[model samples]
Target: MNNPTRTIISRRSRPAKEPLSKDIIVKTALELLKSEGSSGLSMRKIAKALDTGPSSLYVYVTNHQELSAFVLDAGMESVVLSNEEGVSWEIRLYETLHSYLTVLMEFPGVAGLALNTIPIGPHSLALTEYILERLHEAGIHSTSAAWGLDLLMLYASSVAFEQASRAENGTTLQAISASYRSLNDKQYPMIASLQSELITSDGEERFRWGLEAILQGILQRQSKFGI
Candidate 1:
């Protein structure tokens, strides 16, 4: 053999293998998002995690935002929407909301991605379909129900993101919960009055309460409009 023609092999000299499927690429990207948190994930990082070049990821996902959408949808899949509650959209919505929140809680940083991306992926569309079905069951009109579900979904995801941001920024729910009891009575009467009960809520009960308020508001609208 005549010593290596060149000290290094250029990328153009390599042969292309089978491309990675979008599913595998998306899955690996999501795992990387979970490991490094949304702020820390990047195409290069994802490619490195998948043992491929950054350009390979683009062959599947367009970019980080697209990848983020996929991650949110993946997280949404963990949400269980049971129709066992029958036509009680309120109950079904309630349970579904809690379950969705639970999934976000399990993947701390993932919620923030949902907040920013807003689930435009196939999986996210499935979630939108689920929510619309609930609104329809609750007697909401097509027009109102469409936008109403959108707002509700955005709110839920945003709240989860806020919680995650706070946690990552050095303010955990536990610490915030503890601080609630020490509120200044003179400055904030309501918070001070219900501070203990309020802070004691570990996102679950608070989310349920918020969901109830939304369902009740929806029901009120239906009653008022005679829908």
Candidate 2:
């Protein structure tokens, strides 16, 4: 029998992998986060997805925490900082926050990251500056504006995390309604009485109400304390 012939292939025939950079790494991390939620953000998982060793990722990102900060800011790239002429500061603020909430809802994993990560990236800084500017226009300055920024971001992040968690775990409003229904009126009079209002409104109404309340409270406090 004749020996089988072998075909030799040149290594150059294969396409070159894209050069790794901080931007590429962050983009890949964001993609993983979107597809697999928070679990997909690990260095090993990202490296595996990029067809490289986990150690290679360290060349750009120092650690998982830093990588998380990058991913969170990258995800926020879509948040619109609208500056339409004739738009009131309050309207612009609400629009910007709504855009942020929408982005978080779209990429639920990033919502969790936003809550945990102290974002120092350019995009994050831009967001902070924009919010501060809006607060200044609203006559909230100094300590009040600074603290109000924290409160606003925190509220949005917390709401997104909670809604995402519930959606992921199949915890529907119906489930909450049933739970509320089972509560005894005598034992929890206030909760039982307000159960309908508690679970009734769509998320939008509640989110807007929360934002309005926060803005009002901030203004009231600023005026009263002169801070």
Candidate 3:
């Protein structure tokens, strides 16, 4: 058998010459994550990647959880949020969510971190504020907007995690399509009948459709609330 190609974040042979810092640690951790996934990340691995002792890492990050939190926030900072005026609230909200999901997809390991950690980073805070503000501006009720943001985050993170997990398992979505197509028609007539439509998306079509459906549902409810 041929050797599998190894893909790492950075091709450089040497670690960065900069002094040890939280930024450096977080960057190195991200690089490690790109190659190793969440399960492969640890203080020892990070320290080794940085050519430092594991104990020294404690000065920058208190523990694994804190380090993971930092990584999560760093990923959030990479998302570019456009707060341009005059854009429809629906468009702005959709763009913000798409940007957030794009960032998480780029750093799949961060999906794990996002789900497990609470982010207070400036970028994360800004995203939350932007979403709430846009929703309220759209005349969505305050309560609905708050819950809507939560629901959106949950959906985005879970989607990112599923994509990452499937990639790591060396599984293709075709497997899912095959399984659905093979289900017994007699036992699950509706699912079996709809299998073609259910499994036919070109990856992003379904995500976009789902996002629009969710936002439309929320907006319909907001209209009912008369807010």
Candidate with best TM-score: 2
Which candidate, 2 or 3, has the higher lDDT? 2
TM-score (all chains, Cα) for each model: 0.78, 0.94, 0.82
lDDT of 2 by residue, 26-105 (tens): 99999999999999998988888789999999999899999999899999999999899999999999999988888898
Q: How accurate locally is residue 97 in candidate 2, as Cα lDDT from 0 to 100? A: 91
| Predicted structure 3: lDDT | 0.80
Candidate 1 — which residues are off by over 4 angstroms?
1-19, 85-87, 162-174, 177-184, 225-227
Choose 1 or 2, whichever is better by TM-score: 2
lDDT of each: 0.75, 0.91, 0.80
A best-first ranking of the candidates according to their lDDT comes to 2, 3, 1
Give lDDT tens digits, candidate 1, residues 27-89: 776787777787546888777776788897787777778778877787677788767834566
Question: If both were scored by TM-score, which would come out higher, candidate 2 or candidate 3?
Answer: 2
- As a TM-score, model 2 comes out at 0.94
lDDT of 2 at 12: 98
Q: How far is candidate 2 from the true structure (C-alpha RMSD, Å)?
A: 1.7
Which 10 residues in a row give candidate 3 its minimum summed lDDT?
A: 7-16
